[model samples]
Target: MKPETPFYITTPIYYPNAEPHLGHAYTTVFADILARYHRLIGDDTFYLTGTDEHGLKLQRAAEAKGVTPKEFVDSMVAIYRNFWGLLNISYNRFVRTTDEDHIKVVKYAAEVMYRKGLIYKGNYSGWYCVDCEKFYSASEYLMIDGRPHCPIHRKPLEWTEESTYYFRLSEFREYLLNLLKNKDIVYPKHFRQEVINKIVGQELLDISIARPKERVWWGIELPFDKNYTVYVWFDALLNYLTGINYLSDKERFRRYWSSTHHVIGKDILWFHTAVWFAMLKALDIDPPKKVLVHSFIINKGLKMGKSSGNAVRIEDLLGRYLSSDGVRYLIARIFNLGKDVEVSTSLLDSIYNSELADNLGNLIRRVGVLIKKKLKGTLSSESIDNTLTDKADTAVHKFNKLLGEEYEISTALQEVMGLLKEANAYINSVRPWELSDPSKELYTLMEVVKVAINLLYPVIPESVSKVAESFSIQLGNPLDISVDVGKEYVVKEAPILFKKVR
Candidate 1:
């Protein structure tokens, strides 16, 4: 079905310098869930996720492996795609920064900025991290063992000086302040204040947007200058626009760009907001509709990163959970946009065994067995219990509010799980097993299950699809769900969606 309203969301094109980890899965899965939700509501949705291939880190990593940068990323991109496929990421486009179209778009934008005096040649010297591909000032870098270190990697920073080009990021200080204050561009409200505080306390200096080819040759070169390549960060940021065909397909770009939501981690908040918005302003384009920032998933008392070596492998998660849906459910349950989530295997096991296997899975199994044994696998329309109906209605309302308005995915899952719990208790109390004609009770329970499953479909799609098929439920728009109980249902064999781990 063709959707009427356009909705677009993007995950930060990940740096594919190494194998993907839980940190990468966390962000991509969250974006996938959001994209699924929008599609569920009949919105035209486009999801973009890809690899950030051009950078000093990739170049160095490739050199260590005795392969060209292109050869290395070519192999790494396959791994990323396979991992995303395993997790069931439903992205419409997986854009690579090394793609010819992306490179052209970067050069085109750079040329335009230079022509309009928004970009100029300049000399820059600062402490830089090859891993992060950005400069850190005195206040931003951490003092570690009497040396300045990259806060994220906790590695020693290199002091480098070069003649480069700078983007006039400083010129839009007042504009950014007003935009942040007046518009609902950033999510969780507090993140907005954090950016505002930074702007108020410090200066927005013109950012260096080019690197000398002698230092970093694996990047998009400047259109006007052959001696320099566009900074990796600057080139990377343009993938968002390139993914949407900003230069090639203007009409399509306008449609999706108007409702664009860039999903990112808090570490890059300044770049996405302070730098990105100004770049758009220079291009005479409107800022993205929302920059949804999420806090990191912490493991072992530190942010999970490949460099940190505390990162959880995606294979380990899949091996433990036994399915993509299981991993997806765990991520959705712990998803947080405001605060860092400290994660462990025990936490993942508890949520899976208690919620998916015990509560939701147990209810489906019991209900399916009783309905098949008693009603011979067919049920006619009947009046649903008002108490259960009211609970389902309330859960749906709160789920929509939390997910659609507040972007609180964890709370939204809780609301649906709460409804499932209520249904489980309702079944135990009603005891449909004892009664000979338990159609009414069973019907009520199934209605409640339908509501819960629809709400959860965005998170655990595979499990939800299985339950939907067994229970004869049409997984339609969640908003269309009500407890009217007007249709007939055919119960097939009961399926165990999630088996308890140990």
Candidate 2:
């Protein structure tokens, strides 16, 4: 068999009905970090994130704002782009369902199923949540706060009726079961198990796949019939493939599609891992290779949503915390991969001060400060002793093996911080501050400090550049990342790298 090629990953296309929130921001940033890492490590990686701009949600949001659905969705998509930009989310492609290529792919997908008799004209009358853009089963409606609420969005469910087209999802029960049996379908093992227990273990129901154009005209029109538009999920999910022109760009798609990983909040896991797999199998296409399911971000132990009026806006975090890496690090380190994690201002402050400032930042300041002290503010090439090279090599090897090879990001970050801790301990033990003649061992201390900055660059990118300035080293590209301690050395000492915020 040919060697499996490179890695690709994506955040779920977000609904553009509301302002961006931390719940949404957290997902994209985590995906961005993984994408950045894969690209840095030389994978032919593709990272896509964008807005899903169709469905009842868009229609209703437009009505509330006294505008056309197009205007409403356009404004919402802009918020998503700006908010993500603030977070430094490096998305390779910001695909929109409204994009012509995406529209064509969704139509093509619908046509294929229509030809197979897998789509049928049907009546859909049920409790719909405009916020979720989904119809809830009778069992799913909640009576919390003395009202029938959407379990996912916690808003009152609306009653509606209309003629629609439905995908013969029941027809794919066996196909989904067989696909789930294939272990490579979704990754990290635990996430796959959740899909099995929840999606496959439950009876598959035929899904409503198109909306009557009269009711909601914001989506791609079904090619088989012009009276209806494809369901928002049907149209939006295809952006993953259509973003790369999966059908049109055969060779290109073949390279990245199978290695693709979709990082989504648990709310949409069914659509991504299950329904997406069924659709691909029906079209004789490969399903996304992995789905990394994440739980929600709660605030003060309560779920945050629009109606709750407590949604933590993305701008709030970015504005208050100039600590961009600090927020990213806190989310990645504290979140339990497959379980809900809470967020609060206090929690954010704690992680910023405790992890980034006290730990990583303090380490950088100490080493760079000491280097400037001994070398008289100009780094010396001979300030590094060759004897300490082995220890540096061993530490970097252990971290790279865990982070790059094993996909253990949380463990990897912990290990990266461990390297910083070791360096701080080295400085304390060597007491370079006490060195008057500054012997060969002082150079050994410089070598150790230099190695710590190189290894920590991938996680805290900005700080690395500053640390490089102090060492008189010019890092070519952060993406051209290097963890090799013995590779090359540039020793020119400058000032301390971090200034702690009061």
Candidate 3:
């Protein structure tokens, strides 16, 4: 990828009916890491994340709270913004479905679809999951204790019938099947297979695109019909287009939309790959360049939920760690890209102590102390060590390859830590403390540390910044493994990067 090339990516807009949890933070943080990596390598990157505020669920929850839906969403959105700030999420834009610009684009898309004969007047009768704000047929819901309940939420399903506008989703059945056949539509082949089975197994029915305005008054009103409101899902999906100002700014939209990626959870694969892609085809627009589907973060073999008392709050986890970077480090280290990960406080503590505090932190502090004491806090430039150079090159190459191809974040971090362990072993073998003049050996050690920090800057921004400051090097240098060996380096007094937890 060239520096001038553009890269656009997004995390699905969270449904803010409740507080943010580990699942929400997980996806957003992963997107941020990729965006940062693109920027570090000099790409024009745009990263977006936000909340979904308007839906039947939001209206019902707001009524129960004795406040209007807008007021309720306003308070809930603040919570999401605060948590993302605490975790240092680097998103270029925070888009909400209710924003004026976003609303305009969504309405524009609905109107365009209606004009293309892709949407038509229809009636719908089925089981509706109010919690998910989605409609399900009989086969989609599960039977529980003689009554039908939503498979996703495990709550009683509501039987409802209404006059609705329907999108001709079935018309795109073959279109979607052919689209999914392309490997770039969804990664990790297995997930793509799941999508294919879903479309093939179930009869592809035309989906409802509007709800009677008298019943759900909080959503965007349909431009063609005064008595109905655009379906929340229709409005929500347009957010991807909103990132480039699809309705108002044409040139900008073309620039970014040409190559776009979506980071989503496994649960929403059908929504993104099937429905979202179908809508794009109806509009005669190209589908997103790719979709990166990831698994959930669970506890005790169950998905994290507030009612289950297993959901871990971002604030609670951050408070337990020495720095926010510690929390970020552990999550990225333990996260399995395509499988669910079980998280516990004990697991977090153990990983932090062993890899971060013992291996990585110990290396930085030891090297910094040696130079400050023996070499008078000054480093003389020396040719890069061949052995260490090979190790650094291999780590950087592996990191880039994994992130670019497999999206294997945890595995990438393991490779970087492997390089750090090698550096630590070199220190013990050379025993630089015994050398009256250890400038050359110390220089190599510092170079290794510098390379490690640069590679990790995307994952742990705060801690890496502190490391660069201690060595008096400019942060955000172009991505590379080579250090500036000709320039004299100065070491400064700084606090320990990671403190060992008891």
Cα-based lDDT for every prediction: 0.90, 0.71, 0.84
lDDT of 2 by residue, 1-502 (tens): 5554478888888888778777887788778877876766567788898888888878887988999988888888888888777677888899988888888788888888889988888888888887676678778899887768899788898887778888887887776767777766565567777777876567877888887777677777889888888878888888888877677888888788868888887778778877888888778887777787777767764332232467776655555556566556666676556567777666667667766777777765665566556666443444444435566666667767765655556676776667666666766777778877553454555555565666555555666677776566654433333333333334454444333443
lDDT (Cα, tens digit) per residue for candidate 3, span 213-331: 88888999998888988888888888999978888888889889987989999988888989999999987888898898888776664332233377777776776675778878887
Candidate 1 lDDT tens digits, 291-370: 99999887774332233378888888888889999999988888899999999778888999999999999999999999
Name the candidate that leads on TM-score.
1
lDDT for position 304 in model 1: 21
lDDT of 3: 0.84
RMSD of each: 3.0, 4.2, 2.9
Ranking by lDDT: 1, 3, 2
Worst 10 residues of 2 by lDDT: 477-486
- Least lDDT summed over 10 consecutive residues: which range in candidate 3? 299-308
Q: Among these predicted structures, which one has the highest lDDT?
A: 1
- Scored by lDDT, model 2 comes in at 0.71
Off by over 4 Å in 2: 1-5, 127-136, 139-161, 301-308, 378-394, 437-451, 474-502
